[model samples]
Target: MPLTPIKSDDPVHLAMQGLFPDYNPACLEPAQDLELLRGMLRPRSSGGVKGLVHRSFQGVTRRCPRPLRELLLGLAHRLRCADPELLKEPNQCEFNRLVAGVRSQGSRQRGYAGKRAALCLSYDVDLLSCYRFLPTLLDQLDQRGLKATFHLLTDWEYRLDPALVEEVSARGHEVGLHGASHDVALGYRRDERIAGELRRALRGLGKNVHSYRAPALCMTERLMARVRDLGFRIDSSLPMSSMFHPSTQSCFPYPLEPSGVLWELPILLQDSTLFLDLGLSQEQAWSFVETHLKQVLELGGVGVINLHPSWAAKYSGFHGRLLDAAREWSDFAVMTHKEVYNCCRWGGAAPSAPAC
Candidate 1:
């Protein structure tokens, strides 16, 4: 698909306006804005005051007077939050006018072609143990005739079998690049270093890899641009919730303006955050997924779900139940990430085959 200028009232355009009321696409450089927002949203490690003080003072703070230590840590956090390097606001009035002009032109664009809602199953294979469950997972998906996209990590400690990767592609599923080594700090890397890492991972993955997801869903604008320049067709890294807070960005796929050529498949929900991070029970997590699926379908948007293979292996019963529910859902098309991106891009007919 070719990159085209987004119309003023496109959903993505409006969503961007809604997200950063002060955002001005024309006034601000895409890389600068994206980097600023990235730094603002990047997740922070959980640490207590003592932990912070120790790290900041290099272990000397632990021996300092308790009151002095507390004071130092408080000032440090306050200074960090007020850092000028982190805050940059774009022109909101111009952005609003831009989106309003587009909205005035026509209705917002729907994410899926033929106005059909879609459900995309995305798996991030981060560990070697995760690879062992692929056959079973593939068999289950094949039985249901549901397509999926697998994001493989190439630079991890263990090696991924190239033969297995080829087998996945042969089964009509999509294989996407995760990262070179699953680095959580990848978003903070310099542009040159980031490009080199991506190139290395792409080379390791062999040919025909067209999609990417940042490690831990942490991404910067430079990283995205490099990915596009590197020949990726889509990115599935943005999320509704980031390291700092939940975002108001749409959960549908949309063209990332400035970097207009690459499509973004924003994750609607993730199993790891829901189950492991948030401490939601398996039943509750699946229920949350079902709820979001129905809501997105009603709005005619795509719902991209992230499920790690290692977690699936551990919670096989829960994973199986979720897939079973997905197979039975008739309103949405269950497809791979690439299929959904293509359908949204070319405005093609909806899938005619029954989801089951």
Candidate 2:
């Protein structure tokens, strides 16, 4: 008299199967279905899913819609009743092959991509040590046949001898903005204040300021939007390290929401993070950089190294070791953040930049 429950293989079951085709109704009991339905009514967790589900959900979230999100939350609950051995055991050959296929494709981009690296030689102009070391650092870069983007603070430029700015530009280096003043709590400041700081920094550097890295490596979504509004093309504050990596997927070098004009190039490694955050010796730090750079280069991906002028001056032979290590790798084009963004392909943007 009553309609029969559909089998997982039945056509009717396809509508509720969600993302994966192998998901089967046979794997779930009637009690599991009731539990899943109940979970659907609960609010989504603020921190998102937990544990292995967190890893599983990353792939799922990128493409999931609001309705699909609810469906997935429910589906996950039902899926838990699946055979423990099936879930816990290493994937079968077909699944492993599928994973390998995706990984190989993702990695292939890094390998034929050309070798390019950007050395951002920056000064938080407010720092007195930076003033002393910047000139020396510029000379060193000249000898090494390298150039950098100098993100300067406007108000503090007077502290450095005036000729130094011209000398840096003369030697083929770039001067951009740090901020008008180095606010100790810059990131925690209000949005308008931050924008004002950027404007003041730009005004001090003269109008040629087009690229920016945040003071203290602190950037919020609002700050990024303000940067775009100000006509800057790139943001270099994104962290490439595991601990400080951007909290959201949007931080990766790609198109933005509003203008689609701004590009975010994450700093793969910074000198300070090695010296201060990790308390690693320069040699130890160089080892980490070498390993990461080799991996990225072998895969054909962008490798960015941010070196502070102060550190290079303080640590004897550190800068030389960094340059020597770079010489061992092949097919890398080292440029500034602005150069990379202008040349890098984002969405429809053409990759006109050369392999320098």
Candidate 3:
């Protein structure tokens, strides 16, 4: 639907126009309004009062009369009032926009030119079974000269040999939060459980990380908001498409709503899909991954491949072949998860509400 313009003389509309200046009032929604103002407040996910965007709002105090800045801030508060949960914690929105700006730059550089895939071999280390294959999997990635994000669990953070976890990080691979538990049925309890899990994993992973792939890919808007409140810039939980083959690959890194954090990439062909879902053999699974890669390349989009540590163990040779194919054929950046997240976050021009 096309955007409808607000009446020029209304107080709220006028304030928005003056604040944004360059953005068309017709193009703005309540969510977009919140995002733009939030973007003006903070760039990094970290909390505190020193954000440049936050200071810019403060500049209104110096450049304009006192009453005017007060009026604008008041209006911003009202505009951001739609979600009480969101209004309560304003920092998440600003941090999301900051990350979005970073991502837009990376996307521009990639330029929709050739097939550039970002295969995320995310290991949701929330299960004992998943961790059983860590040594071999790490060695495999190392042998192939590839790096990936290990979305580790808080429970195992201290339990895992510190040397092993450090090896992944020190080798220039990324480490992401995979929540603290591996419950597959979090959809019902997500609202209550998400914050605690996210914060736990964040503190466990050290404070510098920004990306998270939900445990079991079980995510919802409410869960995403919780992740955002915990200050994550990228959520790698884009839904996998049902289609396959070269022409059918249709995954790309787009922003998710409620949080506005850039979804680094989508999970297109998961390694376990064949075993757990389709019952494909080793040869069949390899064919599927290769075909999906070709389709992603042909479409000039990012190719996101997901593999579990447990699945890699179950299908040993398949793991080696898939990585080999990715290295040889795919033109995608092959990012360590953090690099992909930092690259796409909102920053340059204000991003409107993401396409639902």
Candidate 4:
């Protein structure tokens, strides 16, 4: 579908236009209005008195003593968000709006080989608990004759089991990399620091690990450039979920530079955000996933299902059902990140939409 032009010289409109290049405001059964949809897709930024306070608060927080920053603040969030029941106080109404936002944002295009929509089940193996749940996850995928990408942790709190990595790869799954701990600083650090950390992580895992996603989706151009130079074929660092407040980046795949050699694979609806950060109930979380995913499928775009192994094990009843449902989706192909990359790169996919 051709993008409907917003024929206006207004700077505001131009910025929004940039955000939604192939803009097609979907008119669903109930007829969601254009303005309503625009509101949903709008990129919010802080301004005025409140913006000043926000900046001040952030500055003060950053200036805090190292001990307080490392232990009292950063470490607290790291542990808390990983806990199943401990929430970061998310807004339920915002979540509902996000679910609704999917309905009106319209179809996205790129890199899929056929008319059938694409699905990629990606797991972030961050915790020891997440590592423990791998066997069961592998069995489920095997039973369903499906494959997924499992990104192992490196330079995190502990190391991932090399044996487990071999097992996953042997079963026709992808072994990707999650660079460091959930600290968001990986992106903003100096170039040499980031490069050194990445080199250390890729030392021996480089050959097998072709996909990389940053911890907590923390990324910058320098960071990604380093990743691409390090030999990662795909980077799933930008998260797509309206609940991410002002940054509701859609999870539509596109080629990253060095002229499309490396792909940008964005994931929508991460389990860590739902189960650990927001602490939504299993039913609520799964419902949100199913609703938005079906819409994306109908739009003929790739829907990346991101599950943290720790959370999946915590709510196996729901996660298991999700796996079973994948087989029933006769309309789509569930693939690993590497598989998607291959299809788009070599399997005659249409030219992808501009990078998100």
Question: Highest TM-score: which candidate?
Answer: 1
| lDDT of candidate 3 over 250-320, digit per residue (tens) | 25454443243544355666664556556679998888677766655544445567777877888988888
**Which regions of candidate 4 fall more than 4 Å away from where they truly are?**
1-115, 180-182, 204-206, 245-248, 348-356
**How high is the lDDT of residue 253 in model 4?**
57
Q: How far is each candidate from the true structure, as Cα RMSD in Å?
A: 10.9, 16.3, 17.7, 8.2
When sorted by lDDT, best at the front, the candidate numbers are 1, 4, 3, 2
> Between prediction 1 and prediction 2, which has the larger lDDT?
1
Point out the higher-scoring one by TM-score: 2 or 4: 4
Question: Which scores higher on TM-score, 1 or 2?
Answer: 1
Off by over 4 Å in 1: 1-115, 242-248, 349-356
List ranges where model 2 is wrong by over 4 Å: 1-103, 106-126, 156-162, 242-252, 345-356
- The models' CA-based lDDT, in order, is 0.63, 0.51, 0.53, 0.62
Q: Write the per-residue lDDT of candidate 4 for residues 177-283, one digit (tens) a residue.
A: 88654445566666898788777776635344678887656556677778877667788876555343233244455555425567766676677666656667888
- Highest lDDT: give the candidate number: 1
What is the per-residue lDDT of model 2 for residues 1-356, given as tens digits with 9 covering 90 to 100?
23235543322132222112233344333433433322221112222233234445535643555456547645644554323222111122221222233334332221113443333333444455677777777766677777677777666434544577777678877666677654424544568986787776665565565567776565655666677778777666655443433321111243333233665555566676667655678789777777766654433345557776667777657677876555434466656665565555342244432211
Using TM-score as the measure, name the better of candidate 3 and candidate 4: 4
- Candidate 2, residue 293: CA error in Å? 0.7
- Model 4 earns a TM-score of 0.68
